[model samples]
Target: WSLGLKGERRDLAPVSTSYYRVQAPVSTYHHRVQAPVSTYHYRVQAPVSTSYYRVQAPVSTYHYRVQAPVSTYHYRVQAPVSTYHYRVQAPVSTYHYRVQAPVSTYHYRVQAPVSTYHNRVQAPLSTYHYRVQAPLSTYHYRVQAPLSTYHYRVQAPVSTYHYRVQAPVSTYHYRVQGPVSTYHYRVQGPVSTYHYRVQGPVSTYHYRVQGPVSTYHRVQAPVSTYHRVQGPVSTYHRVQGPVSTYHRVQGPVSTYHRVQGPVSTYHRVQGPVSTYHRVQGPVSTYHRVQGPVSTYHRVQGPVSTYHRVQGPVSTYHRVQGPVSTYHRVQVPVSTYHRVQGPVSTYHRVQALVSTYHRVQAPVSTYHRVQAPVSTYHRVQAPVSTYHRVQAPVSTYHRVQAPVSTYHRVQAPVSTYHRVKLRVDK
Candidate 1:
């Protein structure tokens, strides 16, 4: 039996017969016998005395509960998409390109290499593959140094197009030289088609054309065409025929003569027989006879005529008597008598006295005389009777002498005297 505890192991057995037999005092027997079993029965139910014992237990209290600490969380999410763009720099040379974006917003910045270079960026030029942005679309562009002093602006309205830009030009001056002196010219636009012409004397001129220009150079002058010269002159001569005949003669025969002055005579022979004669100067003289025996005679001066007869058959005659003798006598017989001149006497007679007497003076003078033929006595008288004497006797008789004596002496003496005178004188 064990003490009856609240939680103890106990054994129980059936109560046997011998039990109650021994009553042992509380300490009686010294020997401890470990009974394997004991059964006890008690009839008195009474309370027993108790002693104090210690006990340990888990405790239950009201404690506060803590949850996971609350913290602010942030999440990163992407915003709605937008487009940004930049422009490529354009070159001064010819340009080409392809576009990267269709609806992109583009911005532009200009940076020129030199101050003279310009950046035309407001309107981007169109290229083959890309178009310039509209309105205020921008680009980054640049330019190099320029060639000339003149400045130029980029034309607007950026088209989807491409073209070449020509260089700028300036005016220059030149002078003419040598023979071709003057020149004239005028200003022109960029493309000059016509040339200006110059005329007149030598002088300087200014000319310009439309375009860029270089320095002035010389050109050749135009050539001139000229005509040749000629010389001096004269004329020609002419002639006529051969007609008429000509002859040369002695003296002046006016057959032919040169042209004569006033009053000049031209003597010509007419027919076969005529004679032509010429005097000095313009006068000519000629004498011509026309009869059975035609003759042409020319007398130079004056002439006279006379005639004479030597013997008489007693025909008629004419006499140019001498200054001293004057007589007219005719006889029927032949006779002779003496005629006295200043110193001489001549004798003449003729038989045919019935005709008148005649005498011819061969030069200047003539003389003729006649003698008495018979003797007879004179009776009536206041007259004288003359006595005839012989040849030598010188005798004179008066009228008073006797007639008978005169007859006797005159007869004999006259007869003998005539015979004797004829013989002796």
Candidate 2:
């Protein structure tokens, strides 16, 4: 426990050394382990029923042997999960587990060093979707079981959807490395398999990828998309940089900057209006994007049909489990109206929009104005509908400016009409 840890904590002590149990409180960072029963055999039981806001650890190392039975209800993680190192030896039984955000900087390794048996993680939404079989390398997973029917059923907090996976065993995925830029990465290796789904435009600069691969597949959209692959591809979206070379793979290689393994899945991705990107697998709904949805790489798997997104879509990294709209996070987009007034023939409107909204100009030489706006020269905020700069960047003659309007004015940004005049150089 650290010096300053907040939240409520409870301890339940039992007089048994055969098995230990722990119940953790939400919004907490510290957890005390129940005393070990024996060095030979270990067993754990936990009951979880709550909303986990941010349950993460910088380095979570578990070196033990256990047969764990978990009871869960309404289990939802509505944020980013960055598990730097999670090492466990147990059977995780679960139901309706969902993570709704981008997972970055992940390294998952599971091994049975001394004939240690059965280390598994199961979920209803993650839903035991992957039977990862690899040995010896960085992400080396092997599952040896007779008739292991991996029934892939992806369920969000909403409805029920499904898929299936079948593969032969014994291949260790070694040395998987890359600079990963991702958003809305859903359903990776057992709810840990990540592929980005972005909405809107994407732009990438100085992007790179490096890896040695077995097989590769790539697809590109219009407007100058560049890809550099070292191997052959069957399913590839957007890839940059370079890896060494190898042979064949049966998996899907979508978007990534750097990867060095037999099967590589890490990528630097962006969304529509997204560059260095993958894409929002536009499903059965009608999202009226007034422009082309820009993405470097994207493969729309079997997502939902009733998923609806409206207005100027901002950066909404939505994660969904099958049949569970629990994570169908409908983020509300704010509305920014058009600026009404005249047009400013002012030269060099440096950065009219940035990550936020920046309208820069030489306020000294430029004359500013408001509404009674001009007849032409309407400026839409470069980012989203929410970025309505009330500042006097430009406008027509003097009149009341709309509360949510942007007017590019050239003059002494002497602000009238209670509007702010931002003169950024």
Report the number of the highest-lDDT candidate. Answer: 2
lDDT of 2 at 365: 18
Please give the CA lDDT of all the candidate structures: 0.17, 0.21
In model 2, where do residues sit more than 4 Å from their true spots? 1-21, 29-119, 123-206, 212-287, 293-425
| Number of colliding residue pairs in model 2 | 73
Q: Write the residue-wise lDDT of candidate 1 on 1-425 in tens digits.
A: 44345765333432211212222211112122222212222221221111111101111111111111111111110111111111112211112222112111211111111112122222222222112111111111111111111112222222223111111111112111101111111101111111111011111112211112111111111111111101101111010111111111112211111111111111111111111111111111121111111112111111111111111111111111111111111111111212211111121211111111111211112223221112222222121222222222221222221222122122121111121211111
Model 2 CA RMSD to the hidden true structure, in angstroms: 22.7
Instruction: Give all candidate RMSDs, comma-separated.
Output: 95.8, 22.7
Model 1's TM-score against the true structure: 0.09
lDDT of 2 at 366: 22
Predict model 2's lDDT versus the native: 0.21
lDDT of 2 at 323: 10
| Global CA lDDT computed for model 1 | 0.17
Off by over 4 Å in 1: 1-96, 102-136, 139-425
